[model samples]
Target: MKKKKMISVLLTAVMAAGVLSACSTGQSSTQNGDNAPNTSAGGVTTIEFWAAPNPTQQAFWQTMAKDYEAVNSKVKVNVSAMKESPTSEAGIQAAIAAKSAPTMSENINRGFAAQLSDSKALVPLDTLDGFQDIVKSRSMTNTIEPWRFADSHQYVLPIYSNAMLFGWRLDTLKELGYSEPPKTYSEILELTKKLKAKYGDKKFLWAKADLADPTAWKRWFDFYMLYDAASNGNKFIEGDKFTGVDKAGLDVLTFVDSLRKENGLLARQVTDPFENGVGTFVDVGPWTFTTWAEKYPELKYNVNYTLTMPPVPDDVDPADSKTFADTKGLVIYASATKEQQAAAVDFIKWVYSDAKNDAAWFEQTMLPPARDDLTSNEAFTSILDQHPELKPYAENVPNAIPPMDNAKYNDLQTIIGEQAFNKVVKGGITPDAGWANMKKAIESALK
Candidate 1:
């Protein structure tokens, strides 16, 4: 009851203290390339692109086409997309059955990139002309950051990324006399309790726990990464050469289980969570832009959100609080011919690396830019200006750990979510036993 009032007062006070950030909740940025229908010239090399209509993706292809076409008048590009293949095998199947698939295509970023990596169907992007300089200096730094690694060499062109931190309702925390948000993992637990206890009679609540949404998985991935940011940290995805999983990582995972404990301290929308305030803070991505925020504008004044990262342990280095990164890259299709590659790269590079659309883009589509450069662009300025607290997730890119991965990506998260849910939510297993069950299921599934 007190925490809610404190948060509310703090939220209001923050405005006087200069609380200017975007109030806009963001939509999930998809491979939503701005691919539009284009006519090709006979003498020009035409690259066929098959993708879904991503009305809200960052670095839209259509915008890129205008610039690429302006320079490569001799090269032509054609793009078409269907809906519903996002998590389905249809895209791959369609490619397999096609007379000839698009010379260039959009991938699932990680999973699809992995597929392309496995099938050897994609061109080595680093070999493309002018790629070395762009990747080595600008693109890799400005774009992919640490995500620029390839298993063998440089095979992917990373365009954008995502990370997890924390977001809580400032209004809900005001009753507790808190003026700022928590910065460490242990602090998050304490703050969670504070909010739960503070908001007694107020319409505002603090902190919702995320569960089972693919959009929310970045936080789950980040929680474990808080302990270690290295590629194979926590052994979430074991490579043949590395052996590392620490107690800190286990604690984070267990904490996640704790979020959904049946005693009901946590929040999940199994039946529309945000609607009921099951838990105010949720580990989520931009999807909340449409799901929760747009529908309830008043909620913005009540809740303040930011990315959820590992808080600095009382005894540990604050830098170590950062962990886990979600890499979203652009994958060029292998079937794209030598000639098509020329135009494709030009188009992709221009939008991802150059075009500025925070206002024209996000405002029109209700989405957020994946580019670090545009986080506070005019379209999103109102948001960043008011909610300066979002900086943790926005700024933690450098220390981000990688998103979850397994041979069968879907099956992996499904198993983890199930094991943890069964143990913590269903009362069927202990946390340790649940983790053991997760490891066993993962190993068996791998085999």
Candidate 2:
């Protein structure tokens, strides 16, 4: 991690005024600032930004805003903390409907961004100056493709990303006479069976399942991880239409069902497998490593843990093993004034253009950088070196698939979870029946 620098005189003055105001009022509105517009003094354009509620993220936005204000005195940034939840979408939508939306927002996922774009509420990033070049220089085409709508308009600027990866307890593997982790789904199945036989009463694998309320949503996380690997980057939707389940999807469902039945993998909810040493094998994101290090410092540099990209089915190409990349970025509102939009773009560009700021962001968030260049940055690489468990994330980024930009994703997920997943996993229905019901549900939802 890099050392913090002293704040500029101008920023210090502004922060001092805010501190005094809070002291006199016994509280500060800056803490929430949601939907509340700030008045810009001295004819400066105030760009309202609703930021995610993460403390580090909020601090990052405020620091960037003050830095931008110091350089460009004509623009002032008013950042508000937005909670990351379904309610956030409603709040943003309400603001947009009232024509009082913020100039930009953080933590806008592809699904919500697409919804906003469909309603003509987003300013396409491609229409902004220097944005395309940043995409070409910093991000890969595959990473950006998921955010492009049917009209070829990109509505979000991705900043950070995370992907699912396979994790195994190395000490457990060695005790079981294995030198390496499974390479494919078939291998995992075979390994799980052996482990089950050896430890009949204990759980051998931490597979995804929801026996109590088995729904398509319960299986979605694992399904997409394998689906991306099987389909090799094909999205579930194309041109505002649902491309219903294919052979790849069925294969994944079958695999998941089989794991629960034969592998002694618990279908019930449990605590964090990696943290509590609950399972020999688990699938997780980058944050798992950070959490483990922070809670169990004794295991910080222990080589008893191994992390690798999720394995594909035996029939699928090994090189095609992929996982879903959860991308969060900034999005500008169509309701924003032209000047405010320009300022929003400038602020994002300034933050990403400098490697130091980008590196600091990764260090603070523990999320992988969206930019390709940042992978080679010493600041970023140094952190990876210290926490070797996070190395798999950077290695898997090249094959990571972004989520589909479908507004109906949430609805489709509920249908699949209830109609398809729960039925197949616990309702004594055949996989084919579940698949057919899922297809019908998706079709109905799309209409």
Candidate 3:
């Protein structure tokens, strides 16, 4: 409770401070006129693009900007790393409050984009010209459908989606007389019993400290992953409504509770539990392979480990399971001029029209491109051949569910952990009580 309250107070303070700064600087709450229409005297429309503050992402955008400028002389793209004062989101918020936000940025998630859109700070991408062309050309219609906001507007152009998966120690499963990892709750429970009967306290199905942490983002890898799979990608929140499936949420909590009963969960602070083989199963993302290559080279894909979507409920089809998407995308600020907006969209369309660009992105950054044909596209075949572990993520891009498009997603997700998931994991509450309390709290929060 203190942690949540403290974070709320800090965010409030930051926003308030931004308002004060704007007022002191003689700036209005609205965008300054000088920030728009940054066109050169030569009739070239200039758009500022703030890339995510990372070396690889910055390099990718910088290269793309140079390449784009070489072909199209009418548009100028200036790429720079987004400022991260404490955090990138906070920096963006501060910039918006001061009315100096970039023309477009590439690190926006659906939830934060919702907050921006609610304040009318974002331009709806779907309403822009040539938006459908980009969708058709990139072959991302199905993959981009879930990104639509409650207002039926597409505010973001998703670049990469890291479909969350579970990595199981295949060697350990083999030692337990299993060739593959379990895919359903009952199957996992049965495996848990055998694991306990053999290794006792030395092994666990999952050993992650974040399970008991009430941090908002922690829910993505644990609760949301399982809940999405169990519910088959149900949108837990649509706009301001708490639309989480009751049965799926309860089943997820109950599954965690079941695992706890079998001594299959360890929500304690254990360093590198998955890599060290202390935990047989843990949430995996495409980004992990980079670290594995440098540190745990022995963790070969399909050799000693395998990746699959989060396990589903007993009755749900494991083959059709869905998981949460760790995704971020580009969004144009409404503060930009119409010309700049058009130019930004044109740049996006040009960048995505070619599959080789996406292939380069996948190769430079480990993140999977948000396209439906990634697995079948000849452009990506060689890349997938080099990194077989990424094939599942590519195949499941359409199956991955993005985060809720709610401005209060942080608070809502925290309630899930504090009222339901964390409590159940710690054996402090029954699944029924946890579900009811969580639903009530989330509904109240939504109101």
Best by lDDT: 3
Local accuracy by lDDT, each model: 0.47, 0.67, 0.88
Which residues of candidate 2, in runs, are more than 4 Å off? 1-43, 83-86, 137-142, 207-220, 297-302
Span of 10 residues, lowest total lDDT, candidate 1:
1-10
**Candidate ranking (lDDT, best to worst):** 3, 2, 1
Candidate 1, 113-220: lDDT as tens digits: 444454455566777885665554332454454343335444555543445544554544555666665665466567665555565323223223343332324324
What TM-score fits each model?
0.71, 0.84, 0.94
Q: Which model is ahead, 1 or 2, in terms of TM-score?
A: 2
Which pairs of residues have clashing backbones in candidate 2?
A: 215-417, 216-416, 216-417, 217-417
Evaluate model 1: give its TM-score.
0.71
Give lDDT tens digits, candidate 2, residues 73-186.
888888889743345666666555444567889877777676666656778889999787667656545556666777788888777767677678777667678898877778
lDDT of 3 by residue, 1-447 (tens): 001122221247768566445534433223365544445548998888999987888999999999999999999999999987767777887887667777899988888888777767788999999999999999999999999999999999999998889999999999999989888899999999999999999999999999899988889889999999999899999999988899999899999999999999999999899999899999888888888999999889999999998999989989889999999999998777787889999999999989999999999988899999999999999999999999999999999999899989889999999999999999999999999999999999989
Better of 1 and 2 by lDDT: 2
State how far residue 218 of model 3 sits from its true place (Å): 0.3
Clashing pairs in 3: none
